[model samples]
Target: MVFVESELGLHSELESVNAVKILIAGGFGVGKTTLVTTISEIAPLRTEEQLSALSASVDDLTGVESKTTTTVALDFGRITLSSELVLYLFGTPGQDRFWFMWKELSVGALGAVVLIDTRRLEECFSAVDYFESRHIPFIIGVNCFDGADVYDEDEIRAALDLSEQVEIRYCDVRDRESAKQILISLMEYLVAGANSGV
Candidate 1:
């Protein structure tokens, strides 16, 4: 199913199956939107509704006081990994109240990329715990922020108390290459786990 995509407008080469829905989820202000848009080949479809004053008062801003708007429902995007594999990224809303809706969006997902903001590490705990409880395979990518102290991988693992089974690494959401690497890493982890009988 190998083929090349070129030219300005568009073209579809006849090919075999090569697409899956992969979820991008995390807590509020964790850079889900940035990561999805960075790696998507087409312009990312974002359902970004403006934040209202009343809505702002209820949403948690513990460490992300600077964040103005929140993801209301879901954000959508797409990325082509190769001629044989393409990714449809469904970005979940980060707030806890959206938990009920998370399951629907997560259905049939191959895996998830949980982005963590180093500045708000605590916010990630619930998301991690949720995935662990569901036995859903996932990988964590820490989003490095400006002026933040870099924490070693082991240090992060220790602080999060993540089991040795989970995969964790650092990435910059704004960097397209870095974001792609995270997706590849997660896919590799899932393949290895499947091969190892997980």
Candidate 2:
């Protein structure tokens, strides 16, 4: 006998299948991987390599002087927002050499979070430009690192030369709640853009 939609339990499953792909992006030594690990329901997949003297010239360790590992390709994670909504997080590698992977990683992404560290604000320029030039919806998540100087949203936006329409959020990527809020802000931004047909 053939099962009906309700009888087969596929009705709710099919109707509640809203899955969104979002990129957690930023500059070198930013908290892209940490953000994914903090909020992902499953164990986050990190394509990180240990920092070596061999590549010291290529990778800049400015603000994050003690960063031991670097994301070589991408970091992957997933979080279920609700029965009707799920988010797949793709964290991009920050170094210049690994940037080629971004094209692949961003293929199906609907939006992105550009995580930035205040100490090295210039590092995020490439990421900001990448997303902006592509017209991709993104939010700037300023990662509040311990001992880092604090800047208001206006200052950062001015420094980044971002349009006022862009959203900015402050967060401690290591904190689950803070990271989740950043994702929430992105979702809200994306939803607003969609509603406006932007």
Candidate 3:
């Protein structure tokens, strides 16, 4: 929890606020940037560059061939979840070459939202492994792309090799309400774990 100096003089009435760090991580073209932009209160900062022809061989574009730009570094955004809490979101670049930045971005993060595209579930394997090995709590947000086949939560969990404790939810990252729910779900999970001493 964190306390801030308020001009309204409402500190005495309201409790201290919490500022949490959260990571939005997933594979390339998985809508990490879209999710951040959708829910941020302020204009989000994005470090994206036009896809270069020279790097075509290095970056795979099987499903997302229409993508013109790729995040080179990271995306930063913030949202006030409530009067008592605010969330800082950091979206990691999805390319393998930029994975070195994940270690830095992930530091001090409360938890993560692993966005997934059903068309390329295999692309998220590294992210899932990274979070699991570090013991960081995370929930899977399956971005339902148009025409993409939908899978039940249990099936996705088995495919991702996740334990029963990890939660999986369907989401449409482009919708602000849906994006907000993902963050709320993560916070709820974190609070539950803290209460359970897990």
Give RMSD to native, each candidate. 3.0, 5.5, 3.7
Query: Which regions of candidate 1 deviate over 4 angstroms?
Result: 1-15
Worst lDDT 10-window in candidate 2: 1-10
lDDT per residue (tens digit) for residues 68-99 in model 2: 99999899998877666778999999988888
Per-candidate TM-score against the hidden true structure = 0.90, 0.92, 0.92
TM-score: which candidate is best?
A: 2
TM-score of 2: 0.92
Query: How do the residues 1-198 of candidate 3 rate in per-residue lDDT, one tens digit apiece?
Result: 222333224666445767789999999999999999998887999999999997788889999999999999999998876666778899999989999999999999999999999999988999999999999999999999988999999889989999998989899999988898888889899999989998
Candidate rank order under lDDT: 3, 2, 1
For residues 65-109, what per-residue lDDT tens digits would candidate 1 score against the true structure? 777777878888877666666778998888887778788998888
Clashes of each: 0, 0, 0
Error of 1 at 63 (Å): 3.0
